[model samples]
Target: MTDSRFSCVLFDLDGTLVDTAPDLTGALNHVLSQHNLAPFSVQKVRNTVGFGARITIERSFAHYGKTLSEDALDLAHAQFLAHYSENICKNSTLFPGVDTVLEDFKSNGIRMSVCTNKTENLSLDLLEQIGVSHYFSSICGSDTVPNKKPHPDHIFSAINRAGGITEESILIGDSMADVESARAAGIPVIVMRYGYTAIPSDELGADLVLDAFSQIPQALRDLSH
Candidate 1:
């Protein structure tokens, strides 16, 4: 592969590009507290994340040894969304060296985009709040396409939205969802070991395992080769 093999870098939002677990778990705990349920720890919720808010809130309820009925789940989800939307990015921060790495990508003229399971408006709001929204040419959230991650459509759509061809794009992500989607879409993928992946990052079988954002340029080069 040559440098021309990749012209875009698609990223996973929550755990990969930013440490959103603080606000994400906080909102879940807020909803749980409303029902007099014990709150979930940030670490606990971090492990349950990557699947999206409905699932995160669902798992939080389960962690308290209680399951919600369909109607109850719906109501709880609404409450969680409301609270999360209001407090999005309150404590979230970009991972170490992300800004500098992104600047490097921009200087190299590599297009960048986001493909996340978070809903579109919420994802955009969070990115905007964190002041990195300008970095992504496209932000394809769960609702932005017909299907979400672990499905190839999400990856393809993100690349397309960024005006990059599939063969000329790679993904930097943190979960099996990212790996599976990237693989399915024939996109080379690099995983961040420090992000909120459910399984071991190495075990995810990404083209590269990046322990820090600082390793990104090298990993992208290796993947291109």
Candidate 2:
């Protein structure tokens, strides 16, 4: 893209920019093992992800045929957090072509930001560890705002932090939450096919759907034209 249709680009961290499933699944399974529950398959976790930590915890318990209580959920959630904090990037990797796409955006002078449901410190830590921290002008995690994805607060907050307004921004994400958030924020969104979404990508209601990150630059270019 020529970086004209949008002044800023907002990204969803987990499934969009990076494949963080390994760390997340590892942490969830670790917590399950502690309670004598069977580990969930990676595919199962992938299908259940894209929400926040609490929903992931609840889904984990439900997957194991266990009921989710507030106390148990809290404990399991903490375990996941603690475990992931130490091993966030153990096997995590950026999706194919992500670096190139990001670099293209940066080279084109498009402002970029991240809005994720992951905790602030964890998101920042992972971004820094993965060598993409310097690309974004602002990174807003769940804790950075009062609401999470599916809510416009994170997207709007990121736009504000990036010094852009809603009319001149776009959200790039891998789930329906991103679509909803962008819709609520009065911006357009593009969804990726390879991200962790609860349902099919076509049903997410994004302005565009891409199968590869490498296609993003061209897609944006087309949009600008």
Candidate 3:
């Protein structure tokens, strides 16, 4: 295999690499049902993802025209986390072509890592259950760094953990957080068209906006030139 132009490839976990909305929605609905609230469909929940479970829980509460006190919110978050951890991969699956793309990256000698807004332990659990944990040299989450995405420290932490340098790294993600984080870190970012975001991918102002997971390696090759 030939060496790749990029030494390190950083990915955002939830929307970029995996279609986790189904299981996320399942856990969310479980929490909502506990409070006797109506459940949101997976399609509806997709827009609420990317920020992490707490935010998703908060959004769900807001949707029901209710507000939670700090302590209540914390308890709800705990419930969501516990349930999600147990059912992490119940319906979660990698996006089409993810395994192939990851294999291509590995064969080309590129180091890879995951940087996500999900909690560290949960992220690890999900990745492990999804069967792609072996591909990432490092997998960092919201609790892994002092600051989460939109803050450069998260990206830096992931790169450092993966033994990667910023100058030779690039980010592939599907949200404003990813775009902003990569920009703050002074790295190129690619946004996937189909991801869990309210805003369109093209509107996120990424270096490249791709429509399919299969297009990533070629997109990176194009960026390298």
All models: lDDT?
0.88, 0.88, 0.90
| Model 3 pairs whose backbones collide | none
lDDT of 2 at 123: 95
- Pairs that collide, model 1: none
Segments in model 2 whose C-alpha atoms lie over 4 Å from true places: 1-3
Better of 1 and 3 by TM-score: 3
Q: Which scores greater on TM-score, model 1 or model 2?
A: 2
Give one digit per residue, the lDDT tens place, for model 3 in 90-161.
999999999998998887778999999998888888888888888999998999998999899999999999
What TM-score does model 3 achieve against the real structure?
0.96
TM-score of 2: 0.96
Weakest lDDT window of 10 consecutive positions for candidate 3: 1-10
Across residues 1-225, which tens digit of lDDT does each residue of candidate 2 receive? Answer: 464687798999999999999889999889989889888787777788887878988877876678977888888899999999999999999999988878878887889999999988999999999999999999999999998888988888999998877887888999888899989988889999999987899998898999998987777766666
